[model samples]
Target chain A: MAQVINKRIILKNYVNGFPKESDMLLNASATIRLNLPEASNAVLVKNLYLSCDPYMQFRMRESKAGSFTPGSPIQGFGVAKVLDSRHSNFKKGDFVWGLTGWEEYSVINTVGFLFKIEHTDVPLSYYTGILGMQGITAYAGFNVICAPKKGEYVFVSAAAGAVGQLVGQFAKLSGCYVVGSAGSKEKVDMLKNKCGFDEAFNYKEEQDLDAALKRYFPNGIDIFFDNVGGKMLEAVLLNMRFSGRITACGMISQYNLEQEEGVRNLYQIIVKGVQIQGLIANNYLHMFPKYMEMIIPLIKQGKICYMEDIAEGLESAPAALVGLFSGRNVGKQVVAVARE
Target chain B: MAQVINKRIILKNYVNGFPKESDMLLNASATIRLNLPEASNAVLVKNLYLSCDPYMQFRMRESKAGSFTPGSPIQGFGVAKVLDSRHSNFKKGDFVWGLTGWEEYSVINTVGFLFKIEHTDVPLSYYTGILGMQGITAYAGFNVICAPKKGEYVFVSAAAGAVGQLVGQFAKLSGCYVVGSAGSKEKVDMLKNKCGFDEAFNYKEEQDLDAALKRYFPNGIDIFFDNVGGKMLEAVLLNMRFSGRITACGMISQYNLEQEEGVRNLYQIIVKGVQIQGLIANNYLHMFPKYMEMIIPLIKQGKICYMEDIAEGLESAPAALVGLFSGRNVGKQVVAVARE
Candidate 1:
């Protein structure tokens, strides 16, 4: 078997509050076999793109289950091409996307989360974002959980991030009036001008979130796609209309806090007859085929626009992942490791 | 026209913190005609049994919408006899349960909330609790919202209260292992010994709510019918099982507070894929006939036990309404005004 240098990003320690690039170390001299072992059932792949998601922050924390182990390569959703395979479902040279390591090559044993990429007409890097985990998350969380109706008023928090940007677009496609909140003025401009949102605001600049929400959604929000939880969620609660739906997709704001901030306006939920639901993408993976059927045409027709912030190499993975916390990346953050 | 003195419980002023008996006054001098005016289209109901509900507290506050006007009789759900009717739906001598005033005689203008009682086999006072507003609330919150499955672990806050007790019994009927939390040992005893709950705990006795929940529900709670929100809700969020359902029925704990307590463990909601929905009885009134179809049979077969704490006469209404905040009234609090 041919051996190759597999550059990897390994966890140095379990992160406490606010993940730092120092917590992860890039190992450039690690070597791996290009082919799978004869008796092994795992598939060997060359990683093409690694996705940086806010949910990965949870895995970096000290946890008994689902936490990243120290001295090991961190795992995340990635686009890859199979170098060798002993599994019947996957073959050599097949492009796929699923849970893979932040390394040049990964030997994947569990095939449950993995999916073969069918359409090559679009960008392969999209498999790490719009056509992958984040895509399914936005589709299910917005369409299914929200059950939004035409002419409804929609509000999305962290609206420049991977899932939030898509949810805002989905809301517009559903014939709804949509407003979004991001961290920076550039992100707000991108949301309004590029993504076709009715209005967008920089949440960091707003001293009173409640007043900002009221100004954007004067009639009150009918569906709230919450990417940043904590204070934003509380503000949204106060501004929600009767029978409003809230999708609790991610709490990026509170993920780094030692003690998560308390939400005080929950009483508004009862007053407005609101529904708050937490969504996990894995649960909605069955809808991927349906999602592709809708999204592919929208992309081809130029009806849908997806923005990606691409990091240059595997060495940039740590900064790309850490930048997510401080709102450094404008859209879906993907690290380009190898083109083919 | 025959004139009659209508004894009424009038709000003297808007309550700020905890409501006191002095906040309301018994207006015994008020008089009204026993018959409806020639041109007026309304139902004149003789209030028989007045219900003391926690939700009425919201109406006592100074609000632009749905707040009770000062110097007017406080309104609640009650079983009434129609003395005169100008409305086509209701007629004289008809028994009804709906939103009526806390008074001896009420000329109800809006017949939208009113419902004509079909069966007379059960006690009329039952209409104030199990067979009326609270009954429909518990049924819709548990059966429809929670969607309970057999062998699921169920928990109810304010478990000894009117709606809470019924929800526990409904959980038992669904073959779920139910646990209840009340304020006193007496209520806890009633929950376990009388209501068929698997376990019952006096929350006041336990300093740490998370520890208490862990001790009772080691496997984690699958369905949580929350009546008293605030701290208990925060604790329940930590102990919820994956895909757990929570019905945000009534937040009696925070209703009187100047600032409602903030819930800190909402991240657990996303971690567990939990769903929290608010329940207002008016929203689910469309399901009342369906609820009656289920509950009436259960009541007839003695499969359901509804406990009521009767406060004699209309004079006791003020104290009875105030007692709810203190958990002073066990089970359903009903004021027996006129039996005939």
Candidate 2:
């Protein structure tokens, strides 16, 4: 077997506050063995689409045992093709999506989460977002946690992001009156025009979020899909109707803050009898098959839509991941590591 | 039928901040007709035990239409005996419990919520606390919302008050380890010694609530029945375990503040996968019969306990109501206007 040159993106050190492209070092010197080690369950993959998710920022910091290690290639959800496999479930040329490194090639030891991609009709890059972890996150958070009803008012923060975009669309499909908030006019326009949101607002331009919410949802919000927590969550709390549900998917705004902003209107939770719940997509993996059953048909029928901001090449991985924190990406950010 | 002099407590005006005894004025000149008008569904009752609750503070302020009107008799849940009735469901000498004015006598037009006291085996005053709205508040907030499993760690704030005390008892009966927080040492002693809480602490005496919660809930809190929100809620958020449930019953600490204190640790809701829900006991009225079925046996068997801080007369109503904010009264605060 011929020796393949493996280009990898490795973190220089544990990050402090906002990450930068300079924090990562692109190495082209690393090489991988084409042959698998004897009896090992590991599967060697050629990475295709590397996901740049907001949660990857949490792993970059020095945390407990499970957090990403410094001087190692950062790991995240990605779409890849199996080149060699010692694992019984996966074979050569198997298209899969699971946890992988920001590199051209990755030796994956855990094959439990690696799902063999069956559908190839749509874009393979969709597995990095709408068909993978981010897809399940939006699905479970909106459908399971928020439990949207027809004609109910729904508000989603970070509405142009991967999970937020899907949640807004799901609410719309459920016959809900969906409104979304983004950081910029372009993203806000994308939400309204492209994502089919009933209304969208640039949160940065709004002087008072409470007034903005009151305007969008005159009857008060029934479901709040919160991606950016802190001040927006506080405002949403004030505007929640009786028995309103809040799906706390991510807190992108407060993740980097040393001291997170205090929510002042939590008392309204009692006043309105609201339920605010936090969710992680991994916990709801059992519902993935059911979720795919619902979403796959929608994709085929053109009843649903998704947007992506693809950055070409393995070297662009660092900048793509860093761009997520600053709201620099327009949609689902992905790094195209390889052609196939 | 003769005219009866009614000694009533009237709101001087819509209160701006923390209420004082002077904020309520005693009007002794007002009178009520002992006889019912033709075709009237009104029931004239002699008020006995009037319950003073923390939520009453919200009604005291000049807010929306539901708030207590200025220059009107202050109304609340109370135990009363029907002296005269034009309603088909009730006759003279029937013992009932429902919303009634804070006065010596009241003519209640709406008797829908007025539950006829069938189980008088217990004290009539029990209807104002253990067997009344406060009891149901604890039952619904704990059993319905928290949904505790046996041996789960339960933490209750304001744990010696009307709702908190009952919640602690319910958690204990479910085979859970219960801890409670109070403002005074005596109440703390009452929580552990009388209410059967495994542990109790005086939050006022503690220098750091986060440290206190960390020390008590070393394994983290599974269920938190919050009566006093704000800072304690922030601390509890930090100490919550995975999939923890929080019942947001009240925010007594923040109610009087010009600006409610901000909860800085709301991001923990995501970190720990917590579900924090607010409950208005009135919405769970359908569960009252089931709650009573579970509670009546506990009371009759002497398996459950309750405490009352009783005020002597109608004149004491203002002080008793005001005392709740200051944590002056122990257990359920009740004003005994007249004995049955």
Candidate 3:
């Protein structure tokens, strides 16, 4: 077996408040064998596209159940190619996506989270977002949890992000009057003009969120896909119509805060007979086959569009992940570590 | 047709913060006709037991949709006897329970809310609590929304009150480990001893609500029937189990505040895959018959017990309603206007 240098990004230390690019270090000292050890059940993978998500911040905190360990290769959802496999379910040349390390090459012992990529016609990098975990999150949160009906008013916060973008598109496909809010004008314009949202706004420009929501949804929002929690959630509670539903996906707004912002107007839930349902994409992964079946055709037909912010190399992974909090990424942030 | 004095309790002015007894005035000058006018589609009722509910606080605010009008008789769920009727559904002397004025007699123009009282085997006052909106609220929120399973841990805030008490009993009946929080030692004891709750605590005495909940629900709460929102709801969020269900039945704690207390820890909803559903008992009225079928047998078999804090006379109605905010009432607060 030939030895190869493995370049990787490791968590420098546990994060406090917002994460910084310096919190991670690119290490090129590690080396790995091209072949797996005899009798080992581990699968060796060459990482391709690494996802930079809001949830990755949670893992950067001090080690708990799911938190990333200091000095360990920070793990996230990524698209990878199997170089060698001692596992029965996978083989060489197999493309996959799931929880993988922020590295050029790695040996995965835990094969439970990994999924074999069946459809590669629509860009393998799509496995990092629209065709992967982010896609299922938006699908399950909007279509499954909220159960959006035709002609219903829908509002999506963090609407230009990976999950939010897909949620807005899904809501529109459900025949809903979809409105999205983003941080920048470019993202807002992209949401409205590019992604086919009925309306989109730059939340930073709005002084009063409640008034902004009311202006967009005068009759009141029937469904709210909340990717950013805190003030936006409080404001959405005020504008919710009777029996409205809110899907709690990621709280990107409060993830870095030492103390979470208190959500006022929860009483509106009772008054308007609303439902706030929490969503975890992993729980809905069983629907991946069905989701791909529905979404792939939509992508091919131009009914669904996805935007990506690709950072060129493995070294740029830390900055790409950190940029998510400051709203620096225009779309789905991905660090392309290798071509194959 | 003959005229008779109709002594009533009228809203003196729109309430601010917590309601005061002075907010209501005893109006004895008004009189009503003993007979219905020709072609009138109304039912004239002699008011009996008036229910003192937490939601009445919302109606006490300035006239809006579903708000009480100043100088007009307050309206609420109550048991009454039809003195005269031009509505085909009712005849003279028909016992009914629904929305009625806080008065000796009321001429109801809208008879849609009223339901004919079929069984008088139990106390007629039960119609104001166990057999009316509160009963259905407990049933729909617990059985339908929370969907309790055997061995699940359940927590109810305001557990000694109208709906909470019933919910605790129902949870117990469904083979759940039920815990309840009240404001007084007497109410706590009653919840555990009489209501069949596994545990009960006085929330007023617990300085750290999150600690109190952690102590009670060490394994995390599977179902939370929330009546008193605010800090309690926030604390409950921290202790929710994976896929936990929270039914937002009421927010009595935040009702009186001009500005609602912000509920922190909403992010837990996503972290734990929890669902917080808002419940309006009216929306679940279709389940009333099924609920009554399940409950009537339980009540007859002594499997369910309800506690009542009866306030004698229409004069005591104002005080009874005000007392709910301060936790003065030990159980289901009811005003005895006239015992038929």
Best by lDDT: 1
Please give, for residues B1-340, the per-residue lDDT of candidate 3 as tens digits.
6688999999988887778999998999998887788889999999999999887887898755888889899999999999889999999999999999999999999999999998888889999999999999999999999989999999999999999999998898889999999989999999988988999999989999999999999999999999888999989999999999999998888776779998889889998999999998889899988988998888778778889999999999999999989999998999999899
- Model 3 residue A49 distance off true place after TM-score fit, in angstroms: 1.1
Badly placed stretches (over 4 Å) of model 2 are: none
Candidate lDDT scores, in order, read: 0.92, 0.91, 0.92
Alpha carbon deviation, residue B239, candidate 3 (Å)? 0.8
- On residues A20-60, what C-alpha lDDT tens digit does candidate 1 reach at each position? 99999999888998987789999999999999988788799
Give each prediction's root-mean-square deviation over alpha carbons: 1.4, 1.1, 1.3
Docking class of 1: high
Model 3 per-residue lDDT at A233: 93
Which regions of candidate 1 deviate over 4 angstroms?
A: none
Ranking, lDDT, top scorer first: 1, 3, 2
TM-score of 1: 0.98
Name the runs in model 3 displaced over 4 angstroms: none
For model 2, residues B259-333, the per-residue Cα lDDT tens digits are 888888888898888999999888998998899999999999999989999999999999999988889999899
Indicate whether candidate 1 or candidate 2 has the larger lDDT. Answer: 1
